[model samples]
Target chain A: MIRHVILRVMAKMLIPLILLFALYVQFHGDYGPGGGFQAGVIFGAGIILFALIFGLEPAKAAFPPRVLEVLVAVGLMIYGGTGIAAIVKGGNFLGYGALSHDPVHGQHLGILLVELGVGITVASVMSTIFFHFGGRGRKDV
Target chain B: MIDLIHIFLFTFLAIIAIVVIRMRDLFAAVMLMGIFSLLSASLFTVMDAVDVAFTEASVGAGISTILMLATLSLTTSKESTLYQRPRPLALVVVVLTGAALVYATFDMPRYGDAAAPINHHVADYYIARTMDDTGVPNMVTAILASYRGYDTFGETTVIFTACVGVMLLLGGARTFYRWRRREDAGDPEPRP
Candidate 1:
């Protein structure tokens, strides 16, 4: 990983922008050709690139495996919670129309939360898989 | 011009596919697969399926390629050379399956046929009512998130299940490494 100054420099410049673009894609999905799935992959790719160029240890330090494991379930819970909230509001399961007084607002909020859940799970799972694969070669487990 | 672009892309795609199949080098094949994914993404973009294209580019080209490369590093990069054994029965089965698939395509509607059963089905209702129902401008998002939310929930669960499966299979790295270390302790150093 060392001795590639150009790659390191370029990576440093691009990683932040890539993560930012992922965020934009996640939030702007309502009006654009992007969403949780795309945004999550992009974000995971960013972190993977960081791990590739700077070494996996630093990446793992930044995003630990334990935290990633927890996040995998947390995202699903958030998604399921949104559905339960709808059920509590007297709407059918996953019916965002009842989340708020205004059905439209409720739909918006539900979509946002659900997408967030997806993004979190996807990003964490991807990074977690990468970490496990990359760490396999190293002596330290 | 667009047709020309499509033709060029498809040509390259075909060439890459052939090369990938014929090449014995696993690394080159993996890289070519990434290119194939990228070309498919471009074709999806040309067809106005930008969301699909995005997913193809990211998951297909990006993550899968990287994962394959990682696996290559852990295993042999070059494919093992096995003696060629031509099985006529296997070839016959594959040829028959391919011919059946091609034959089935004849009864299908032409590309992007507006009157096709799929196009005339609930797609029209979703397109017309997405904005009104979900207040979302992106009809695809509206459909996936609200109209067919239950299905998406199932899909999300599927992804979570995949992660759990992979974790169960690969997450015992530490324990495996520890066991290997214990086994190695009894053996003398055999390699430089």
Candidate 2:
């Protein structure tokens, strides 16, 4: 019980900090050594920690499996949609310069959209994996 | 001074790898593998490949270890000694491969030569045009998300596929929920 309480408190404190760092990494990718992939993993780690401390049931209650499943598909769709949009704009798939009238702005928008997609998919998939493994029942103590 | 530290790290990494391979306990081996990955990430940082280092530290050291532990929980942790005898044919093939690799390295450019073909041609373009192209200060990010975006997309798809496969094989969230519901229904009296 004591261990559970401590874990809960620690999860509450650490998860927020991790999430904040993930956001920092996501937005600051243009200036630093981080981007969508790293940020996504970090964010996912936060959720995984919460799931670990709290029971998988509670974690599932917090973020339902159905929601995560949708998020995963939606993320891919967002990424693919952006690429398709570029193609529709008369450029190669994911050719962001054609996204807008101003090529630089188009590039920025493209990166942001794609990064968001990557972050969402990675975070959802990772958390889902954690739930699967940690929630598994063990016959042996 | 940094170069000395790097050499030390490399030597330490080799020692750790040998230990991990020789270790009889699977759990200990998995933990050692995590440490090995972390050391490798640090080595990548020392080599100035911070992006690769970050990926290594997160995915390699974190998720991979968790996956290995989960697998261990589901299976026997015993190390099978069935194939303990070293095969002469395998040894000969390994030695030949090593010799070929070493010979190929001699023909390649020395460690950090700026005039090397890698630095002069494709790499130079990314380093120079990254800022202009993607408006990102991190050239690696620009390269990964833009110039080599196809590869990144493919990798992401691979990760997604693997996760889907694992979920399908291991009984996903739906099964877990059903199990919980059955447990709840079995209990007639709700106890706080």
Question: Best candidate, DockQ-wise?
Answer: 1
RMSD of each: 4.2, 4.6
Show the colliding residue pairs in model 1. none
lDDT of candidate 2 over A36-134, digit per residue (tens): 889889888777777667656777888887788778777777788889999999889999899999887788888888878888888888887776776
The fnat scores of all predictions, in order, read 0.70, 0.52
Candidate 2, clashing residue pairs? none
Candidate 1 per-residue lDDT over residues B53-82, each given as its tens digit: 999999999999999999999999899989
RMSD, candidate 1, Å: 4.2
Please give, for residues A21-48, the per-residue lDDT of candidate 1 as tens digits. 9999999999999898889899999989
iRMSD per model? Answer: 0.9, 1.4
In the order shown, the chain A TM-scores of the predictions are: 0.96, 0.89
Q: Per-residue alpha-carbon lDDT of model 2 for B53-168, expressed as tens digits? A: 99899888987787788778878677877776778999999999999999999999987888888888798778777778878777777777778777878777876886788688
Superposition error at B33 for model 1 (Å): 0.5
**DockQ scores of all models, one per candidate:** 0.77, 0.57
